[model samples]
Target: MKATTFPGMSLDIDIQELTPVQWPALEKLFGKNGACVGCWCMFWRLEEGERFQDVKGASAKQRMKALVAQGQARGLLAYVEGEPVGWLTFGPRRSFPRLDRAPSLKCDDADEVWSLPCFFIHKDFRNQGVATALLKFAMDTLRQRGVSTLEGYPVKVPAGATRVANSSAYTGTVPFFEKQGFKSVAERPQGKQRMRKSLVLRRSARKQGS
Candidate 1:
């Protein structure tokens, strides 16, 4: 589907500015289930539950909250009439240890880029393209900041790979990334669906009269 299919639902949602004050809503969204068993959506954050296995839920949340206070903008928030319904975590890839574990993602690039790490949509508002909009906003924000490289780890969905409920598999699916205009520059080095997109470049201002 397309955005138009969901009439009166308003794909023209308000992409709220994320702030520490809004942390509570995010916390509620994750709940005691750990945002799918206490992840706080930190799937790529650890290597098969090594580092994060000890962090627990409440403490991990505290850590993320601190990030917000430390001037770390925690991605975009998808809101419907002031209620936060979805989220997309976008930032420099280095900050999220999850992506580093995947050699195929190649975190060593010094060019400095933003990563569309993951998306979380409220149960009620899912399938409405909310994540896609948040993603687009993230890209637009990055572009305005002069960022040209963005990456997302989606899925190759092996032929006949049986998908299950909440089976995000951490890495998103191919269709989702493709919808945002991302292309596969690499394949599964450790996992599948490592996609990339090159943003439109803005010409640098010439040094007066140069």
Candidate 2:
């Protein structure tokens, strides 16, 4: 299948594998609010309580830059006409400390699954179906890397709940997951629930507990 191209922004987006050079563009896309203030997304990547002071301002920004310097292509970027307008952070489950420690985000299968940690789409591009596209691109990118499964923690909203800040986890909405072929594989006591989609690549021997 061909990759998507949103031409309004002259969106000749090259959804290539992310690298160190791309992190700055990712940061710029996140902007002064840290894509929603104080969350360089180190919340899940940092030790508990260690972020209280560092995750705000320049401190948190620096830390993430260091990770990039270490060659961590934590996620993918949607470059439109050469300017980064979207970002999605996804990687190995264990790589993100917060999700692994979260009550329900934990996985039942031990096949070394990759998880869609979250997203940070620019505010202007919020309603443009960018998040869903990012999800698909992330899956395809990891598919080539040989991931057996992919999972995400989208906010589970019911019929009458009011809309809240998009930054809440920037994880995403449950309906979005359903659209992406993800089903409720696990539920959390809190509103945040784990949604997953199994990749059609290599099968896990772990699937059958012989």
Best by lDDT: 2
Q: Estimate, for each residue in 1-210, the C-alpha lDDT of model 1 and write its tens digit.
A: 011122344565777657877788777766777666666766554545576767757766776777776757467677776677787887777767667666667656724767877777788887787776777777767777788789887766666665424456445677778888898877663346668898865345334425
Candidate 2 local lDDT, residue 18: 65
Error of 2 at 119 (Å): 0.4
| TM-score attained by model 1 | 0.80
Per-model C-alpha lDDT, please?
0.69, 0.72
Best by TM-score: 2
Error of 2 at 108 (Å): 3.7
